[model samples]
Target chain A: MNLILLSPNDLLTDNRACIKNPRQLAHIKQVHGATVGDQLKVGLINGNLGIGLVTELNDTAIYLDVDLHQAPPRALPLTLVLGLPRPKMMRRILQTVATLGVKQLHLINSYRVEKSYWQTPFLEAENIREQLILGLEQGCDTHLPEVHLHKRFKPFVEDELPAIVADTRALVAHPYTETACPCQIEYSLTLAVGPEGGFIPYEIDLLEKCNFEAVQVGERIMRVETAVPYLLGRLF
Target chain B: MNLILLSPNDLLTDNRACIKNPRQLAHIKQVHGATVGDQLKVGLINGNLGIGLVTELNDTAIYLDVDLHQAPPRALPLTLVLGLPRPKMMRRILQTVATLGVKQLHLINSYRVEKSYWQTPFLEAENIREQLILGLEQGCDTHLPEVHLHKRFKPFVEDELPAIVADTRALVAHPYTETACPCQIEYSLTLAVGPEGGFIPYEIDLLEKCNFEAVQVGERIMRVETAVPYLLGRLF
Candidate 1:
């Protein structure tokens, strides 16, 4: 963990907090090899980042005296609308989006998305938060990305999506498209990426109607986990 | 599997091939749902991509009338120098590099790289090839990337790295650097990415002496797997 993320409940005072979670404690002792009086990078959830001076270090917890002074990095000016991936890839995808500074993520259903994927326990709020927190720790950020789910395709695209795409450069990543995915664009973007096989023609047509232009990355197709970072790097 | 990749061993004649492997057979039957006369995308290993018409299909094998014609997508004009990732991540990294069209990859040792990483079975030729093949199948490409291992860092940098970086833009992704990574450069590149926790100052200095510029992606620190795709997207 790059940053010791503290929740409000962990606070003993405005400046004092205790990291009692086994996971964080283990990481602190084992990976970090931190001891008392050593300062560590720390951040408060939805707040600022700073340093935590290790006041007490033991097996159970590490008590810290924190100073919150620095702001987190800027969030990406993009909204990701992704076709819900396979259940196995869900955690990594959530972590990736969070690490890449994606503040808004919409996991929607597509023709190629298996119905069973929506039933995965990975989509549970607690489970999702757990993954996102891990991502924040890796990325060393404070703000969390908001994830929204839409189980139905057409209704989400027809009703909810238009408003989201209104002020952005709407795009859908497709292999069949001739237009290359634009690079280093200055404007905000709302990008939609399909599942394994890709969005069906009817789905593409519906997105097109919502002003989303189909863009191709390259001839070689990438898994969604890889594609998200690739797209973000190219665009932002 | 997006394309049925055929090795020379799989070919029965110039115009025919039979897939008897359980993996391919299951994918063709269960995923593609192919039957006699059904056409599927096919590609020869390190050769052209084309179509395979199913001539016979059963439990044991799927016979095809092969017609290889189209060339595979262009390979990226870049060489990747990566600190050998953890054993568990090695398979995915190999697959990702291949899927992204990277043809030359050097898995080198770094100060932060664990000594045990060098001992992974994933570094074996057959295991590496297996992951690369899976990547090619996922990417719908034919050419497999060449992976080289370097157990010693100093010798590789002093002796072999200069020639590799001579005709290309040499860059090392370092989080401590002030320079932001460039984008959309129309030139070949040789990129070195460190293992988790990054290269030590001495290592960075050595790279600098060899004309490698240290560049940063952003404030957020990403896992090596995520960083590779991110770097490729930004550079290429």
Candidate 2:
């Protein structure tokens, strides 16, 4: 963890806190290489950024006294609508979107999405939360982005997408599209990307009808995970 | 696996071949969900792409009758110089750089890089090769990018960097720099990124002395892994 994250509830009780969990301890010792009295940057989960002074250290645990007063990170004005990628790629996507501090994420089903992928262990609530937390820590931010899943395409397009696109600039990424994805977009954008094979004609029509202008990254098609960072870089 | 990669020797043999290794079998069954008579895209390692017809299936393995007769993937006209990231991020970086098909990679040492990171098991030859293979499989290409390691910064910068930058455009990504990273460059380019906290002023100076121009992605600093794809997307 680049920044040790503590929840607001944890900070309310006392200024002194002891970290005994194996994962956090390993991170403190191995990743941070913390020595006694080393002041480390810390953030409250959904709270503020501050410095945590290490008071005591051992092989298994460490103690810290935190001082938090800084404001939470500003949320990105982007909402990502992604076609559910393969399990491995999805994990990377989740982390990248979180690190970029996107305001909302919609994981939607598409023509190319494998039915089996939804069952992967990586989609479990706890697993998803852990990945988001890691992304937040790496970016030295605290607020977590909300994640939504859409298992049916028709319902999402016909029933839900209009409201989501109502007040936002919506863009969909397709390899064969003519317009290039813009850089430093001024308005809040809702960006949609397809699965590995990409959105079919019908899917594209649905999105276009909903006011999503089609955009292309390059002539070569990139994997969904790679495309997420690429799209974010261009838009942000 | 998007494509089943094979060796030249495997292609030279007759059409019918049985793949029985634990890894390949597990990948076929668990990842690809291949069955008898399935038509799958296959590629010759460092060579051509073709279609494979799965002719037989047994308890332990699957047999494919291959027809190899297609051109290799287009090469990316880019080289990456990255300060070594942590082990977990390193795995993603290896796969991502390989997937993007960069011509070469240089993992250099920097001030913020912990000394112990050099000792990671993921740096082992076998492990690195495995990640490269995974990247190739995901990208549907079989050519592996060459990876280089530079442990001592000063000597590498003074001795090796000049030669490397002789014929290629070199750009270093530092967040505080004034120049925006150029987009749509027509010629080959080399990208340099720093460790977590970024390159110290002295390190940036050495790179600048070597004809490396410093550039920034945006106002926000991105993690090394995220920056790789971001940089490539804009430059290439």
Best by DockQ: 1
Instruction: For candidate 1, list the clashing residue pairs, or say none.
Output: none
Q: What is the TM-score of chain A alone in each candidate?
A: 0.98, 0.93
- Model 1 TM-score relative to the real fold: 0.98
Where model 2 places Cα greater than 4 Å from the true spot, the runs are A11-38, A44-74, A85-92, A111-130, A176-179, A196-201, A219-221, B13-39, B50-73, B112-127, B218-221
lDDT of 2 at A81: 92
- Computed on C-alpha atoms, the DockQ of candidate 2 is 0.29
**TM-score of the B chain in model 1?**
0.98
Q: Write the per-residue lDDT of candidate 1 for residues A1-236, one digit (tens) a residue.
A: 79989988888988999999889899889988999999999999899999999999876889999999999999999999999999999999999999999999999999999999999999999999999999999999989899999999999999999999988999999999899999988989999999988999999999999999999988988999999999999998
Candidate 2 chain B: worst-modelled 10 consecutive residues by lDDT: B8-17
lDDT of candidate 1 over B9-45, digit per residue (tens): 8899988999887988999999888899999999999
Interface RMSD of each: 0.6, 2.8
Could you report the DockQ of all the candidates, in the order they appear? 0.87, 0.29
Q: Write the per-residue lDDT of candidate 2 for residues B1-236, one digit (tens) a residue.
A: 67777765554375655666577778888867888888888877787778889888787867788877887677788778889898878888898887778758899999988899999999888888888877887777778888898998889899998888888899999978789988767898888899988999999999999999999865444678788887777776
